[model samples]
Target: MAEKFDVIVVGAGMAGNAAAYTLAKAGVNVLQIERGEYAGSKNVQGGILYAQAVEALIPEFRESAPLERHIIEQRIWVLNDKSYIGTHFRSDNFNEERPNRYTLVRAQFDKWLNGEVKKAGATVITETTVLELLKDETGKVNGVRCDRENGEVRADCVILCDGVNALVGSRSGVRKEINSKEVALAVKEMHFLPRDVINERFNIQESEGVVIEILGTVTEGMLGTGFIYTNGESLSVGIGVIVSDLMKNRINPSTLLEKMKSHPSVAPLLKGSEVKEYSAHLLPEGGYDSVPELSGNGWMVCGDSAHLLNAIHREGSNMALTSGRLAAETYLELRDKGQPINAENLKKYNQKLENSFVLKDLKKYRRMPHIMLENKQFVTMYPDLLAGAAETLLRVDGVDKKTKEKKITKDFRSARGIFGLVGDAFKLVRAWR
Candidate 1:
């Protein structure tokens, strides 16, 4: 006889661990399976972790989770070849009793989360590949078939917490395979620096960190961005581009990263650092328009599998955790009401997402991805224009302020034309709305 579980959560990623921990703590017999050797083994790159979503699941996460440093500064930069126009927000308020964000190494963080899941009584099986979803004669998913011998396991329902690829979901016909245009390929490297050097270079205390989000030519005019995050003793730097653009241009992601690291505005930051780790992963950048069906009979999808990533805000893990928690809560409510895990009952999960900020934020920026992808000027022409204008205005070379202002206007108009500039602005406004 096959072992039965109240819920079987596939992929022990952020979403999987969150859902499995939530369900197990609620007295549900949950089986969590991971294809990697351990949770987070496939994801070693450093990234930001939003406190609100994490605290919602594990209220005392900060006490034990493998957090690197609390973010006290955030910088957004638009780069030209040799110069960058940037804005930074830094506040001592971020060093308060509970910080809003932190830099974390995903491998250690996920391992910590897996420990929490086990503590919550979820049975976790590592190195297990779930081949496909098992459906009954009525076309309702009821279990999963794994790669191992007699690897069929029954469950009241299954949760697809798979990453951006959503292999199982796609194979089971739950969601369509992601298009290259709707995803981004991000390559990251962790450069090791002494703790004191990191602190001195970033002008931060031991517990504080800085994050830099770069735009413009760094992506080679692609619709993507580059980033640098400060960890305890390392800097996480990376560049990403839309997969479609990469394929269309035959641009190698590694070459682009190398160029980004060599840029004048970025090179000094890592002058003497040693590269300790390198990894790459796909990110869902489709915004709201590309999200597929989230729930069906006896199954639901969360995180990247559901295309819940909000690329505009660089918010993925938080959205994943929120969606996972909401899915678990929805299932628990249904079970309490004596309802079966069907398409009708799982609609509550989608409803919960709609009521939360997850869907609301995604809806707000629904047009951003398309606009950014279509308008190459934001990453190409505008950066040069802004840099030139700033230099012309600042370098007091005996030129009158009025003439310099006129020269800036003429240069912009000459490059983009008036109609192009107006159209780009209009599109940007529409997308931000």
Candidate 2:
């Protein structure tokens, strides 16, 4: 005899935990299977957790979760090889009682959430991998088959929340296989520093942190960005280049990260830090376009498996949580209404996603990836030009101000021929719209 469940959720990350928690609390028997030693053992994140999305699922998380800090400022830096032109936005309003976001270490945060799922009555089994979806003759998925012998376990529905890799989906022949262009390889390192050192370097007090997002030369002209995020006593610094770009440039993403840490503007902040942990993972960069059929038969997909990341905002955890919650909600609704899980009914998942920012924002930026790829100037010439223009104006040269203005204009025009410059500007403006 094989064990069975009302709902079986695979992967146990944010999405899996969210779905399991919701279903179990709603009185549905749910089983969660995780291949990691523990829930977050395989998890990796830059650690910005959006408060509103998470609080909706676990309202008291802040009271107990191991949070690093609350972000009160964000810096966007457009960099040249040796300089940066940037903008910083900081607000005291964010310091109020219910902060909008928090930085969390995935290893601790996911473990805590998994505990909550168990407390909500979900059966969680770790070190277990679901190899395939068991389907009946009618092509309806009835359960998942684990790696163990005779591991078939029946369930009304299965949620696939496996992070980023398309192992199950590719094997299932659901969507066209993911290609290099649809993904990005990101490498990150954790730097250990004392809490006071971190605060002083970023110019913040306890519990307040800053995030720096860098673009341009950081990716070696690849279509991606580099970032530095402050945690309580460590910093998360990383760089991601489109997998296609990585292959074409023949550059390892890890090498790009080392270059970023050594950047003149970036090095000073980490003058005395020690590297603590180094990890690399694939990020689904295909945006709205790469998402496959999210639901089929009795099986549904959420989180990275379905490519539910908002790469533009460096938002993955939030989407994972929201998608997981929506999946569980959809499941409960159908079960209460006595409907069998099938493609027709599961369409609700797609509809709900379309209504939310998950799909909408991706749609808005649908053209950005292609645009950036085609016009490499956005990553190379533009950043250098911005820095050069600023330097010319700010430097106290003996030359007249008019000469400086003319020199800046000439540099810009020569760097990006006048017509090309105008065309690039127009394309960028239109893409954002």
Candidate 3:
């Protein structure tokens, strides 16, 4: 006979912690297993935390969670080698009593979240890898087999939150192996700076932060984006590229990140910062089409494992947290109704997601990924054209405003024919809509 629990959650990232905490808080016997020394040891993120998602799980999280800074400003930059055309949104509204978003260090935040899971009465085992899913002859998963000796544990249901490269799900034939074309490889560095220096450079006060989202030639025509996030005392800077594009273009992600750091527009912000940490992770960018089977007999997949990322908005954590909570809620619903944790009953989990913003937003921009990947001009030609037009209009080089406007129009026509421009606009609108 093996030890038994009501539910077993694999991995301790956003999804896993959320699932385990939700289940345990509901008084369900949940066991969360992590392969790392502790929760968040293997997790990496761009360091943005969506407040509403976590608030739904733990309303008072702001009082205890290890938060870095609340974002008060956002900048989106279309970059060239020398210049950028960008938009900035800053408001006093973000400084309200309850901020909408914050920057956090994943390792600290995950550890804090896992602590909540434990305090809620869930069993957690760290540094132990679940080797495979345990299934009965009926082809229904019921538990997991871990690397430790005699490490078999039974559970009525299993929630896979193992991440983009989850092995247990793929190995157990629960989901298809990830496709390179549908994933992205992101490399990031943690640059430490004094808190006051950070605030001064970004023109903010303590507890206020800034986020810069970058697009354009920094990726060298690859399908991806770069970002810089301000923390309380550090900056998170990174670049991500489609794995297939990296393979096809033979681009090195680390080298690409280095080039982005050296960009004239980006370099000044990072001046005098000391590099303290570097990490890389894969993210699912497949949108609605790439989502795998959500649930089956005795098992459910959530978060990155289910391909629940919304790349267009750079939102992963919120989806992960929300999906995890929904999965747990689904199990609780079935249990209360005296329904079996079989494929038929678990279908409700998928329905729940479909009704949430997690799936709705992804479906809305489902075609954007394919369109962006197919059109290189979005990351290359268009960025350059925008930068050039900005320069043309602002240089004050003795040319009349009307003449400068005409030159800008001519430049666009010369770079991309009128038909090409119209076609690109159509594709963008079609995908975005």
Candidate 4:
């Protein structure tokens, strides 16, 4: 005889832990399984946590969570070979009692979140792989088959929170295999530095942090971005590129990261730091069109497994946390009303998402990924042009101001003609709209 629970949450990542924690807190017999040695052993992120999402799940998270630093500054940089045009927003208002965002180590944060789940009465098993979903005679998913001997456990519903690869959902024919063109391959590193050194370099207090988001030639003409995040005593530096573009150009991701690190605008931040960790992970970059079926039979998918990534704004974990909470709330609502967890009833979950920011924001940016894919100028030619314009305007080399302005105009026309510039502008507006 196999054990049974009300729900089985797969993959103890952001989505899995959120669902399990929510369901277990509501007195549902939930069992969460993780294949890693611990909750966050395999998790990788750029390390920015949007507080509202987690605050909704665990109100007192700040009291015990392993948070690294509260972000008080944000920097955006567009780079050429030797120079970058950038903007910075730093506010003391962000240093409130309850900060809006924080930088964290994923492994530490996930482990802490899982601890909270266990405290809420969920049964968590690590080092266990859920091979596939077990379905009943009528094709309803009823449980999961794991690697352990005779390891079959029944459940009323199964929630797949698997990461971007989504092997479980793909293998069980629940969702299509991830498209390479719709995904990104990101490589990250943790560079350890002294806490005082970090604070001094970033020009911040002990509890404050800074985040830098980079675009332009750092990706080597690929559609991607680079980032640097501040932690307590280390820096999270990484670069990501679309997998399809990487394959098309045969560019090594590590090589690209190394080149970005050596850039004049980026190299100074880590002058004396020693790299302590290196990691790589896949991110869902397909935006709205790549999303698969949300629910069917007795199964529901959320987080990266459902392709719920907002690549335009670089947000994934917050969506994962919110989607997980909503999925659990949907189940609880149905259970309270004595409704069955079937394909028809689970449509409510999709409806809830549509009404929430998750789908609304994704829909708003639906055309962005396609636009970016079609316009290489946004990442390449524009940065060079902007840098050139800035230099030409600023360098007082005995040229008249009017003549310099004409030279700038000539450069723009030479690089991307008037019609090309107009078309690019139109495309950008359409995508944003």
Candidate 5:
């Protein structure tokens, strides 16, 4: 006889864990499988977690989860060769009873989340890969086939929370294969430093953290961005570029990361830190147009597998958790209604996402990916111009303020003609809308 379960969840990442925990807690028999040796084993380093999303799944996570720091300040930098222009938002409000955001080492946090799933009574099997989706006579997904002998496991439904690669779904013709242009390849490094040194450099007290996002020249005109995130005793730094841009520019991501770290403004923060880990991953940056079919008969897709990332806001985990919760909720509701997990009933998953901030946010910035791709000036020309303007305005070379302003204006016109400037502005406005 074949093994059977109420549901089979593939890949025990944020979305998978969230869905499995929710289902098991509701007394639904769920089998959660992972390819890694253990949960989070695949994650080599760090990221920021928007607290609200995970809190909805596990309210008391802040108390026990391996959170690195609570973000108290966020800085956005536009950098040239030697200098940067930027703004920051910091507030004591972030230190309230329940902080809004946090820095987390992905390995630790994911293991913790998976532990919760196990405690909730879900059967979790690590070091197991689901080779393909199993279909019934009517051609609906109802189980998965694993690598082991007699590995077929039947379930009423299957939930795919695989990462951006999403191999099983794509192989089964359930979701489209990710396009190189729609995704980004990011290289990240973990620089380990002492707690005191990290605190001294970022000017924060214990438990408080800072995040820095950089753009312009770092990618050498490629459409990409770099970032530095502070952890408890280390810093997470990395750079990401569109795969197509990398191919067109013929640039290596590692070299770009080295350049970003050596920038005068960035180097000092990691003067003597040791390199702890390095890993690369793909991100879904294609915005709304790249999202594939999310649901079908006896199956649902969530998280990066569904292209649910919001690149504009740099949010992924929040969307992952939200989608997973919604998928589980949809399954429970439809089952209660005595409805089969058919194409028609599973669309409640889509309806729930559309009604929530997930789809709404992605739809609002649907134009940004194209805007970034088309406008090279935003990445290269503007940063140098902003730096030069700042230098002129701040350094008194005995030039009058009016003359300096006129020179800056002339430079802008010379670099990007008046029409070009207007067009860029219009595109920005439209994209932002």
Candidate 6:
């Protein structure tokens, strides 16, 4: 006879861990199955963990989780070849007791979270891949099949927390396979830098770090973004491009990252830094337009598996954690009321998400991806043209202010043409609105 769990959660990433942890804390028998050699071993690289979301699952997690650094500053840069127009925000309040966010390496964070779930009475099994869902005669999901021989387990409810590949959800017919355009291929490298060097360059004290989001010429006109995040003694720098664009352009993501690192505006900060590791992963950028069925009879989807990433803010882990927690809460409520797990009841979970920031923010930025993809000027013409204009205006050539203004107008018109400029402006405002 196979063992049974009150709830079976697939994929031990942020979403599955959150769901299992919540369910186990409620004293339910939860089994978490992960395909990686260990939890998070599959996610070779990623960003910092948002404080509020993880803290919501484990209130005192701060005291125990292996956090990298507290983010005290954020920078946004629009880069041209030799110059970047940017803004930097540094706050003392961010260095206070309880920072809003902290940098994290996914490998370490997921291991810690899995341990927490185990401590909370959940059974965690790594190197165990969930093959497919087992349904009863009535076509209701009851359990899952595993790669291991005789590895069949039953549960009242099953959660699919898989990553972007998300086979379980697809196999169960909960959602369709994602298109290349709907996904992003991200490449990142960890550069080892001395603690003092990081602090000196980024201007921060111990435990305080910086994050820079770079756009424009860095991606070589590709629809993507670049990022550099400060860790304790290393810098995490990466660039992501739409997979479809990558396929069309025949440019590798790693190559794009290399180009960004070598760009005149970006090279100086990374000078003398030693590259320690390199990794690439898929990111869901489909926004509100691509989300599919979130729940079904006795089943639910969370995290990248459900296409929940908010790429505009470079936020994925938080959304995953939030969705996972909500799924677990909904399960507990239904179980407590002795209600049956079916399609009709699981709709409540979707309803809850619609009212939450997860869905609201995605809806708010629904047009951003299409807008960015359509307007290459945001990535190309604007950066170079603006940099040239700035250089021309600031040079001590003894030119009059009025003459400089006329020269700038002529330059803008010459670069993009008047009609193109107006069309771009109108498209930007319409898309944003």
lDDT of 4 by residue, 1-433 (tens): 2789999999899999999999999999999999999999999999799999999999889999999999999999999998999899999999999999999999999999999999999999999999899999999999999999988999999999988999889889898899988999999999999999989989998889999999998888999999999999999999999999999999989999999899987889989889989999999999999999999999999999989989888889999998999999999999999999999999998998899889888999999999998889899999999999999999989999999999999999999999998999999999999
Model 2 misses residue 206 by how many Å? Answer: 1.0
TM match of model 5 to true structure = 0.98
Weakest 10 consecutive residues, lDDT, candidate 6?
A: 40-49
> lDDT tens digits, residues 1-433, model 6?
1998988999999999999999999999999999999998988445877999998998888899988899988999989878988889988989888888899888889999999999999999989899899888988889999999898999988989988888887886767888998999999999998999988988888999899999988788888999999998889999989999899989998888888999887777788999988888989998889888999989988988989989888888999999999999999989999898898998889988899889988888898888888788889989888888888888988898789889899989998899999988988887666
lDDT (Cα, 0-100) at 90 in candidate 4: 99
Q: Per-residue lDDT for 1-433 in model 3, tens only?
A: 2789999999999999999999999999989999999999999999799999999999999999999999999999999989999999999999999999999999999999999999999999999999889999998899999999899999999999999997899999988899998999999999999999999999999799999999999999999999999998899999999999999999899999999999998999999999999999999998999999899999999999999999988999999999999999999999999999999999999999999999999999989988998999999999999999999988988889999999999999999999999999999999999
TM-scores of all predicted structures: 0.99, 0.98, 0.99, 0.99, 0.98, 0.97
- The alpha-carbon lDDT assigned to residue 240 of candidate 5 equals 92
Error of 2 at 198 (Å): 0.8
Instruction: Give the range where candidate 5 is weakest over 10 consecutive residues by summed lDDT.
Output: 39-48
Q: Which ten contiguous residues of candidate 3 have the minimum total lDDT?
A: 1-10
> What lDDT would candidate 4 get against the real structure?
0.93
lDDT of 1 by residue, 145-183 (tens): 998999999998999998899999999988788899999
CA lDDT for candidate 2: 0.88
Model 2 clashing residue pairs (backbone): none
Model 6 segments more than 4 A misplaced: none
lDDT of each: 0.92, 0.88, 0.95, 0.93, 0.91, 0.89
